[model samples]
Target: QQTPASYYFTEKKAAETRIQPRQKFSHKGTFGHALLVAGSFGKMGAAVLSGKACLRSGAGLLTMHVPACGYEIMQISLPEAMTTVDKHEKINTQLPELDAYSAVGIGPGIGKEQPTVELVEKLLDTIGVPLLIDADALNILSENRQLLDKLPAKTILTPHPKEFQRLAGDSSNEFERLEAGRQFAIRHQVIICLKGANTAVILSNGDVHFNSTGNAGMATGGTGDVLSGIITSLLAQKYPAEDAAILGVYEHGLAGDRAAARRGQSALIASDVVEYLGW
Candidate 1:
């Protein structure tokens, strides 16, 4: 028989209660610094969205590492973030020194160039802090299957249906796909956020927690990048990997739900979700 929904599903009440209120005595340094490696020649918007969402989600500091071509755009669009320029004028060809940041989120808008692939490999081999991988970084992994074994314990990977399929292979249906995702998470010792209507946050130990928030309006582009930022912010704040994924997914969807309610589904965009982030 199929596992009971209650065993794996998460509800809004649980999410609401789990969210910790900021302490009045807390300073910016207490929240944590986040590093985001994102953007490219034509995709600087992704970096801007991710960086803005990261700050809005309570990260104390954010540094956006982008290709040279995106430097001006990032500076203009998200003035609050610090910038690190890559030598490549278009695609990311290098990773910044990681020791300074509390956590790192990568792969929003980064194209799958060979150098970019190498950067991902290097990140897997060296990054010691909590890491969250998304967008093309996940795609790079799909293409370079051998790197799977190098992933650090509890690294978070956010993959939509198509991306998950590429990494884990095809399944006959949703149920089969979920099981495939769970198995993949266990096998790799990673967490998987299988994004959809109710995104499933699958822990490494095989617990599947389906988010209770979010609306269909969130299907727009750049939303996933925003999620990567929020989760990375939580990770930087030192929430355990499982808590970060669960809380991040819940809050991301909740923001989408709020945006949808205000603007209506048709008018809701990824930026709207960012604006609606209330916590």
Candidate 2:
């Protein structure tokens, strides 16, 4: 049985790895650069929210690429993060080079437009680092099932039940849900994070780990977007895919807990969760 504690990550130590303490002089690049491709014409807030939360999560640098329409809004809302515009203003098609980014995050407010489908497929095929797919990007993948195996190794997929059903087919119960996630992860050589109460982190080794944090209050808009940002930021910092997902869920939910304390879950908005990210 996969217990909640199964989500605990084992620390990895390497001799060749540089161990810089907090007191040491580390540069911004010491963290990492995260490429976040999100948002569309009407869904600018999604991009802004994810970018802000990622920057807050301590990503060394964040570059958000959105539709041309969201370019100005993103730049204006997030001064700390960089912005780039694609050929289309709405992310109709085409993504930039995958090799240029340390980690990649897609989905979030991205609509399921047919052209965007082609772009998502291309990114799945070409991205060479840890990849995170959320929101409509998962929807796109469901439509393009053939591209599932093309995802890069150690990719982290953040999907709610609906999105999980699309990628992993269907599951009648939590046990079946886990089984599907397990098979999918092993088959694709990626991580599948099925988000819910006791969120499951399916690993490439066929182990199913479940998170203990989070509450029902987190079931709101932009909350999942925040999770995607946190996981992507952790991945940018070189954490393993499963580690990033587990820690990200814990931290993201912890942030939500803090926000709920202040405003109560009834009043809690997604922005409140991001506001409490300092926790």
Among the numbered candidates, top TM-score falls to 1
TM-score of 1: 0.96
- What is the per-residue lDDT of model 2 for residues 1-279, given as tens digits with 9 covering 90 to 100? 443313443222311122223336877888889999899888888888888889878788999988888877987899998887888956647687666678999999989988888888878767777889898999888888877767877888888999999888888998788877887887788888888877777887777666666677888888888888888987888877767776777777778888888778888888888888843
Give the per-residue Cα lDDT of candidate 1 at 264.
Answer: 97
Q: lDDT per residue, candidate 1, 67-130, as tens digits? A: 9998889889888889999999999888899988999999899989999999999999999999
Superposed model 1: Cα runs more than 4 Å off = 1-6
Ten contiguous residues with the weakest lDDT in model 2: 10-19
Q: Candidate 1 vs. truth: CA RMSD?
A: 1.8
TM-score of each: 0.96, 0.90
Give each model's whole-structure lDDT.
0.90, 0.80
- Say which candidate scores most in lDDT: 1
lDDT of 1: 0.90
Screening candidate 2 with a backbone cut-off below 3 angstroms (N, C-alpha, C), the clashing residue pairs are 67-89, 68-89
Backbone N/Cα/C clashes per model: 0, 2
